[model samples]
Target: MTVLVPGIEGRSACTEERLLIVGLGLIGGSLAAALRSSGFNGQIVACDPNADEVALGKEMGLIDSGGTELAELLENVSMAVLAVPVLAMESVMKTLAGSLSAAAPNVVITDVGSTKATVRECAEAVFGCVPSNMVLGHPIAGSEKSGVSAANPSLYLNHKVILTPEPDVLLDALVRVKTLWQACGAEVLQMSVERHDQVLARTSHLPHLLAFSLVDTLARQDERLDIFRYAAGGFRDFTRIAGSDPVMWRDIFIANRDAVLSSLDDFEAGLARLRQAIECGDSDALIATFDRASHARHYFDTLLNKTSYQAEYHMQPHGKVTYRVRPGGQAQGRLRVPGDKSMSHRSIMLGALAEGVTEVKGFLEGEDSLATLQAFREMGVAIEGPHQGRVTIHGVGMHGLKPPAGPLYVGNSGTAMRLFAGLLAGQAFDSELTGDESLTKRPMGRVADPLRLMGVAIDTAEGGRPPLKIHGGAALKGIDYDMPMASAQVKSCLLLAGMYAEGETRVREPAPTRDHTERMLNGFGYPVSREGDTCWLQGGGKLTAGTIDVPSDISSATFFLVAAAITPGADITLEHVGINPTRIGVINILTLMGADLTLENEREVGGEPVADIRIRYAPLNGIDIPVEQVPLAIDEFPALFIAAANARGTTRLRGAEELRVKESDRIQAMADGLATLGVEHTVVEDGIDIIGNGNDQVPSYGGGRIDSLGDHRIAMAFAIAALRAGDDIIIEDCANVATSFPDFVALVQRIGMSINVGGDNV
Candidate 1:
């Protein structure tokens, strides 16, 4: 069945296949043209009622054959594309079913119909049942022009093609359809059949309807001729779609009646508000509306261009971010970083799980915490504001969560995805958790394996990575689990699941991890007790709504602390930083290294200890790291490694195997960066050993290019290392620093650090 379909630019589609395209119009003809141009060598047989269009398609070499006869093309045809008008789809489907049933029993049928619900129903009526090979799709791309002459081979390039494949659709058929669209350079996306219909009705049908109505109304005016003659570009642009095929639009309106009407009602209500504003001369209302629209438009453009400020800001070619830092600058400032990220995430999750509304202050507005907030909103929680570090969560109670429409995408937050696995495991509906590239590469097995022991069915990607798909309603039973590693994320995940399991759940960590989850649970009125290294909680306990005030993150403050310690004449103060007893390994280790650090104005805030930390520059002396402090400062090791590189003697660290599984291998990452900077270091499987000349010796820490490997902590650590660098240090892929510290560059500049950030456009 293979046939050479001639194309433009001396190209030809070379796919050894056959396709029957019914309707030689814009959509069908363009698809045929695009397929050929995309090098899909296939037999393309086109059918149309109009003889002229058939002749033009053949003349254009867009098809191997063109005719009015449908049965002739049905033979040996494995797939058919029905691209006719909406109201004519049923009739076409009926004809195909009756004719192709005998000739090609396995032919896969698909349509480029804008509305899918009616087409699916029409298909069911005509064929007695919509066959499993039938896939419904719509290409969200077109022009006002119609007919074969308007066909363009590049029409679908970079456009969206949505497939509304039913659950029963054959997997092979769906893949084939997706492949064909992709061959034409269209980005194929999937959605439910009903969702497709509703989305198109609002985004497409109603807009066209408005265009036609506006044009028609203007045409009927008394001064119509003058209005048309003097109309500006805005008027013409707004009503451009009014020039589209009238019959096709008319059928679309009738087919998608309810959804279009609903959208129209909403639009009319908005219009009425605008009308009232004009009549009342409410300048404030008019300005507010325009401002909101303008702001939204700009935000959409940013998303479309993948240049949003919060995420992926400073992306470069090949997905790398380069940071240039000048050496020998002291850091001296009095400021606080964002709120503790761990506490911010728990505030949203616990608030959403509680029985009533919960108010939280000092929420980290960083991308990681915001990702968790967005995930809760996706699950039907009414959340308001992280406005200036304040968030209000309308709790849905422990069992009151609606299933998310799709997987919860917790971007760059391993903590969010890990904890959510346990929280979602007890739900009545299934849920899948996904994350950014960095998180997807990190290990999820630690959490998944333990949750499986609790009788939850969880599936991980290859090599124990995400997206983690957790099946719902497992009749989970509490287990006395001993953690293989000292990870707070894994411990929190199990503890959250314990809240819904039968009987009591206890988790024992070999070493102490962060107790934020345990303490936060207690704050939410859920009883949790800690005895030594084991934390236990009872099942069927409800979390009560409460206020949370998150202190500035000590992890973020670590960069500044190290910056001040390594640079001479440096005196910096960090205010309102969390100094949770179990999480102050950074302070303890720095003190042990003989850093000039002091904790001032220490007090308790929202059940967590907070303090103002002031650090003065002092010559550091490296020592063998106490293995007991590894778990306490596991996340801060990257920054600590920077301090060790500037210390007076050899710094040996061991028994910190957990550092290998973070956003990046912190041990290896620091080792590689230190090597590039001409620092002496030894990398082992568990820890790193570094020999330093100390700050007074003008140590041999010459700067060279270092790759951060998309690790935020590694990037910031190197940025701080520039203080002791003999030359300019260049760090790559530092954009991810925004995940925890969005204002790192600005704050560092305010203190005497010289940093230059370069993005893709730069």
Candidate 2:
């Protein structure tokens, strides 16, 4: 097996083999460090434009001879690996070609670039003759941070390295390159450069571009300063990508313009159709759309969990597991969902308040969901679940929730704490809300003030934090309140309380947030009306409980959506997705960007829409996203950011500043990840701005380490980012991703995105 030889005088055997890596960024630096930690005894020569990085590489013992000059570094190296930004790849490759010509030791040359076609073309054009020993490599790994200081030796272990070679390229050289990566603790795959570009455009480039553009657009909006103040979890999640590096992302967009632009077109079309559906109030059409999308989501979820449950469990006899039924003995088909904390809270709270017996199938059984269920139960609502994934909620009528016995413990769900505050405010109940340390630290005053205005009494810790003592049982009077900022949770809470108010409770916002509450309330026969930025929920309205079937969460579907879009020959079906218009911004945006997305099997589950989504590899293009769409797609920003990075042209996003106050500062996390991958981006107060030209621009994941900041969205978003990076991207504190999508990594890998665990190499 051929091994990379660094700082060796002449062609040597295995004992003297070494590899020289230039630029001690996330990618180059990570390779050097990983090689040593993996017990590669051969010498490692490292070079970087930054003297500090060179010195640090030496100090970290990642290389034997570290310097700033390529000529000096290449003199004794057998193979040279360029792990730099996409814009810098050509220059580095040219330098390597010159060095190879001088030494002429049959040395192999390779580069780590996110996009391959352009880089390969540039290499061939610049060198005049492509070397048979040359290969293009991309390792899908990284965190949301950059620089040599963050480098770890184990970064590349058990990660995927994609190698794209020309038709005439020597098989031996390909095997050699593969062997070298394997030695550094990586799993290798092969693909064509064109295929890589197209797939990445949808999965990585387009998402990043949209995120950067979204932040830029929001930051420039007149009402941004005010809107950001009121931003909450959903908004923060939608705009988190606004914090990425400007220059690097700009380069990526321009480099892969064709594919990105195409994706943008498709995404825009989906958004337009959704907007029209909402404007027309075509419930049937809207429900149909949502149904198809929702079913698709379920299919995706099943695919994601295929490895978890043994075949026997799925193929069990019908009577093997005891089934719970109501008094009538009418058994509904068993539908089980993984512990989706967000959907669980929504399902329990909404189901309890509906008019009739609302049977919930596949309710999440995590601590967070139990907290919500327990709280509802204390308020005279019977919740039978945490068994067989079926939750039976005895409807309490719109205004029938009785006063609870004691304070409600919300556990660790910020969602439960905030949403319950609103639900209780509308009822004649005296309730106190409490939670864990992390949840308590989050702000609650936003919901408290709105509820108070609607005639509810609430006392909380300073700054409107949790541990709230609520004095209810007061007659709520409807009041028109303009939301100070954009927040779906706060808006939803007020809307819920407004359902029992004396008159029409009106809520106006400078910017729109998710409207699931409004949509679901309407579905339950509540007369909720919307005009422009205002939503009116008529009080004293009775909610009729119909069979309400929840679709698979779109947020959960994002991992597979991107995986199918990015990994070639990967066409997976995501079934039973919730296609609620307010939650489909990612689908809308990606479709507008020209992704080859299709919806099928559209139908209604209960009152919600469900559908199957089929997304294939397609070209993507960049677009200027409107600020209004931000609130609609807030939960999907992480996946959207990956799409933007692969898009073409300058994709601008605006009116999003809520990214700062999430479980962690998502903006900062995204920025840190992009920088590690050598992608240039601009961080702004409200959002990020990305410039793209669709040329040769891929970033190396070398120099730095990234921190997830304890945010699940951030962790998953960065994991997707790693799929297209050249160097191993190490994500620290990634356990938090389980909070949302528990099996994100496994799901993506099953669809063919290269990923691994407990290792540094991609």
Identify the candidate with maximal TM-score.
1
Candidate 2 whole-model C-alpha lDDT, 0 to 1: 0.68
- Per-residue CA lDDT of candidate 2, range 32-106, in tens? 777676667788888888898888888888777778888767665666787777887778877776666665466
Off by over 4 Å in 2: 1-343, 365-367, 387-389, 398-406, 691-704, 753-762
Candidate 1's C-alpha runs over 4 A off are: 4-139, 143-157, 161-245, 252-309, 312-320, 697-700, 760-762
Give each prediction's root-mean-square deviation over alpha carbons. Answer: 7.5, 27.4
The alpha-carbon lDDT assigned to residue 247 of candidate 2 equals: 62
Quote the RMSD, in angstroms, for model 2.
Answer: 27.4
**How well is each residue in 175-241 modelled by candidate 1, as lDDT tens digits?**
7788788889899899998898888988899989999999999999999999999999999998999
**C-alpha lDDT score of every prediction, in listed order:** 0.86, 0.68
